[model samples]
Target: MLHKGEAINIAPNVVHWHGASHDSRFTHIAINPNVSQGGAVIWGQPVTDDEYNASRS
Candidate 1:
């Protein structure tokens, strides 16, 4: 999870995901401005079985 001071830059039209390790708790807040016309959140692909299995502590 992202702590108080940590930040991430998500580019436009890019698909990505982030979360804490399985053994730990994860929490984060997303802030989006509504001024843009295409202001909406979209979810793409789900985590693959292989990807989940490859995650490390």
Candidate 2:
């Protein structure tokens, strides 16, 4: 897990999901660069209960 002052870079076309923890509050910055195709970001579906619970393990 990423602690305070740490950062992670998500490359283009990569699939990733993140959000606030159930027991803590935090903030983060996500920057997606515009590619030659003119697309910068592609959002996916919301996180389901099963998905979130499984990830916590």
Candidate 3:
């Protein structure tokens, strides 16, 4: 589980997702540089609570 004041770094072009645990709050800042060089952000399907909880297991 992640604790407060912790952060994760995702490299460019990596397929990943993240969020806060239940009964908690999550906040983040995203930095996308070099967008004009064909960089893009593609969103996938939403993660259900079942999926999130399963990962915690």
What would the per-residue lDDT of candidate 3 be over residues 1-57, giving only the tens digit for each residue? 678887787888799877676656678677778679877678789988897677467
Per-residue CA lDDT of model 1 for 1-57, tens digit only, reads 466777787866777877665566667667777538785679768777667667663
Q: What would the C-alpha RMSD of candidate 2 be, to one decimal place?
A: 3.2
lDDT of model 3 at position 54:
76
The residue-by-residue lDDT of candidate 2 on 1-57, one tens digit each, is 878898888877788887866666668687655656676677889877876677468
* Residue 27 C-alpha lDDT in model 3: 85
CA lDDT, candidate 2, residue 40: 68
Clash number for every model?
0, 0, 0
For all predicted structures, in order, the TM-scores are: 0.55, 0.64, 0.61
The per-model lDDT (C-alpha) reads 0.70, 0.75, 0.76
**Which is the better candidate, 1 or 3, if ranked by TM-score?**
3
* Candidate 2, number of clashes: 0
* Segments of candidate 3 deviating more than 4 angstroms: 1-3, 49-57
Candidate 1 Cα misplacement greater than 4 A, ranges = 1-4, 45-57
Q: Rate residue 8 of model 1 by lDDT.
A: 85
Give the winner by lDDT: 1 or 3: 3
